[model samples]
Target: MSSPRLWLVGCGNMGGAMLRQWVASGVVAPDRIDIVNRGDRDFPGGVRQARDLPDGDLPDMVMLAMKPQQIDDIAARYGERLAGVPVLISILAGVEEAALAKRFRTGAIVRAMPNLPVGIGKGVVGLYSESADAAARDQVAALMTPLGLVEWIDDDALFNVLTAVAGSGPAFLYRFIDALAAAGATLGLPADQAERLAVATVQGSALLAAAADVSPAILADRVASPGGSTREGLNILDREDALKTLLVETIRASVRRNAEMAAAARQSAVGLGRITLFPFVLSLSHRPSSPRTGTRRTALRQAQGERQGGSSSRNRTKRLSWCRNGANSDCLEGAAMVPLYP
Candidate 1:
């Protein structure tokens, strides 16, 4: 099937990675993808990037790849324009479907949790959608196919657990790799060589585990002789299921945090006014003292236009000067807002 036209909001680290893979794999043509980001990025040829949403009709799908905290801000800026999009896919961690639905109108709201490795087509993408029909689900699955293993989560809570596990799994594994290398170095091996060996060992072992029919436990046992160094090492990790216990606690902590973030996202409506000032406030931080004749002034004017619906002489002169001096709580008057950086 042909790929759907995709409009991406906030092409940061994870989003940029997915874009690179999609373009390279020919799953989605670069020309068919539109990205709205805070600034320019070196994306594939034919892909368009701009500070604001493109003009004209919406695409078949819209994916939110920005920071989870910016959800309200994005909705405020583009919610009307995005009304009735076929599918709205969000990769923001901890934000739920209901939160998205409350902010914007869409046919289906899908929450996708993807790890960093999706850039290499080896990541796992966990999808969950309560309102989408089978056809919509299938369409989403097909689009995510080139990214990696795509699994549809049955329950919302389970989806959160999956995010804690798969989405955060890569970082935990990196720690283990680093520890393994450090252990080798402690045993007097050259540090650089130890790291190289440790990395390769992990890479080869993961590939083998994936291909093996037997479980990882069986593979470990198969490697360890009745009386050997491997067996001795296994005994330590196996004592009282220490490794498993540690990992369970780690993931449990992550799950709790995800829930907290979800709650915050749901209640973020109260902060929409403050969130709307983010882009303009961010621009102020990098701008020169004199915002006389640059994009900085243009951005300020744009923010004023967005907030107050056109800039007046008084707004352009007095308020603009006040903001250029530096954005503070007083700039907006009675609105407890600060610059994006502060």
Candidate 2:
């Protein structure tokens, strides 16, 4: 298939890696790609690199590879020029499609989470797009196929989990390799030899797991003879599912961090008034017969009295009180008056 006219915004480590892989794999021709960055950097030969967007017609697709925090500024600066681009693929971690939609007017906005390994055509790309039609999605999948495992996420919420797994997973594996090497060195092997052995062992195991029809758990069992040293080591990792538990916590931490980053991006976008909030009901439940109801009732009465007295400070305090009294009529009244921020 012929290459799409692609423009990469902010070609950094991850972006540059993908660009190189695409050109080398023939998924994209270097001559058909353009990269925009503030400063010059090494890029694949025949690809255009510029300090700003190129003149004339927009490309078939524009990929946002800049820092997540730069979303607002980039939108403010280039939104007009980028309006109606066929596709806007973002590699910015934690920045969602909703956030991008608020900024750029495009046919499709795809949130792609590609790990560091993608540079070598061995990475995993997790994609989530709500606006992209079937053809646009297929185009994205085709563009990512040369890079590595490409999985389309059905739910936007799961994107962070995917980021935690594949995006931050490589670093976790590297650390595990380092720990293995350190353990080997402590057991009397030369440090360099131990490091080499650890790396090779991990690489071979991963390749085998990838090729194996059975699960990695089955493969692990295959390697552990009933009375073998491998079984002894396996026992330690299997006890209380220690390795599994540790990895769960590790991935959870990463997922949390991704969520935090997403929240920050959304907050920033809202703070800048670049995004609009749709009116939605926030259901809050409370038992009417609860002992606290009387206290809440008294609080509501006080707030109403204060508002009637025309005290601005007291009015604000009343609104806050009503918000805290979930399910109470006062809360409903407060909900009517309170403006929800996006």
What TM-score number comes out for model 2?
A: 0.79
CA lDDT of each prediction against the hidden true structure: 0.75, 0.76
Per residue, candidate 1 scores C-alpha lDDT tens digits across 77-107 of: 9999999999999998877798899998999
At residue 174, candidate 2 shows an lDDT of 96
Q: TM-scores for all candidates?
A: 0.79, 0.79
What clash pairs does model 2 have?
Answer: none
**Candidate 2: regions farther than 4 A off:** 270-342
Single out the weakest 10-residue window by summed lDDT for candidate 2. Answer: 272-281
The root-mean-square deviation over C-alpha atoms between each candidate and the true structure, in angstroms, is: 13.5, 11.1
Clash count list over all predictions: 0, 0
lDDT of 2 by residue, 202-285 (tens): 999999999999999999999999999999999999998889777765665455445435544545454322211212223334
